[model samples]
Target: MNTKVSRVYPRSLTFGDTTVELATMTAADAPALAEFVKTLPVHDRLFVRRDVSHPKVLDAWIGALAQGHVTSLVARDGATMVGCTAIVVDPLSWSSHVGELRVLVAPAWRGRGLGRALIQENFALALGLHLSKLTVQMTVDQRAAIAVFEELGFRAEAVLRDHVKDHDGQAHDLALLSHDVAEVQSRLRMFGVDDALQH
Candidate 1:
């Protein structure tokens, strides 16, 4: 579990006219990733558990990455970070097989296939770590996000009523979605990600 050992990724993907470099996040990336998160719209930031806009949280993620507790990937268009995805593995022994996925994409990059690419990269990482389950949580109103997950075969697993309260204390329902790692791998193979998954 040497955190410094880099994970190999597939070549960059081309979406429309842009080419996005896909790579894992390292401790050195904290500052840039933090700045990138801060540029996101408030609505996009609402679903994030870690306030990447805060230095402390970014430092925490750096530490986590160094300890191999989390694996994250970033999509960069040239030098600008456009999207990111992270999978956090459960530390408790009882739930160690489970991991949670967090994804964020710039508003301008939405609906152009970047999100799916990010999720696919996360799936490869989860499989590399031998995790059994992956889960994603989001407010129920994020229909587009939900659709993307569903398209990847993730099923709605649970609903926490009034799970999140906004800045004004208004509550929102949260949806929990999960994907079995084995099933996801099979799906990826069908989609021609077999070579990537083999890594």
Candidate 2:
């Protein structure tokens, strides 16, 4: 796989008066990432597969980054992490060409373009990595997040009833959304859009 794409790192994006820098996530970012996750509301954290606020989980994520099992990008306003994303893949699995996309943005930063930009960055990264498919799941109530993904071409794949429980032990329905990356790329190439990816 090429593994090289147009780098969005050190890129500056503005949302209203707020400006954030986008860069690849690194092991050194664990502390800031933990603080970012800790500030998320309980409802928002309920959908996360793991308790990212915990040190061990964050440590494992950092380890994944080192192992190339995960590719992440962090959007920062100075030293504060305002948003982040992860593309997780297990190369040994049968679905190795499929990546799971996880995106999180601070509550205050919601509705801005930050989240969409992070998703776009990850989409390009997925293409560069030669991933054939991408999937994302969230609680059914996250309508806004789901809409954002949908706008980017992800479609509903499945729904699991009461699949995830909150800290209070209340179960919530989960919705899985997926994008056919290979198909999209093929269509884009047919339409001459793939020329941009050649560089």
Best by TM-score: 2
C-alpha RMSD of each candidate structure in angstroms: 2.8, 1.8
Residue 54: error of model 1 in Å? 2.5
Against the hidden true structure, what lDDT does model 2 obtain?
0.86
TM per candidate comes to: 0.88, 0.93
- lDDT by residue for model 1 (58-98), tens: 88888888778888888888888888888887575687788
Q: In angstroms, how far off is 5's CA in candidate 1?
A: 7.3
Q: Which stretches of candidate 1 lie over 4 Å from their true place?
A: 1-7, 186-196
lDDT of each: 0.80, 0.86
The TM-score, computed over Cα atoms with residue i paired to residue i, of candidate 2 is 0.93
Residues 37-135, model 2: lDDT tens digits: 977998887666887877898999999988888888899999999999998888888988999999999988888788888888777788888999999
When summed lDDT is taken over every stretch of 10 residues in candidate 1, the lowest stretch is 1-10
* Most accurate candidate by lDDT: 2
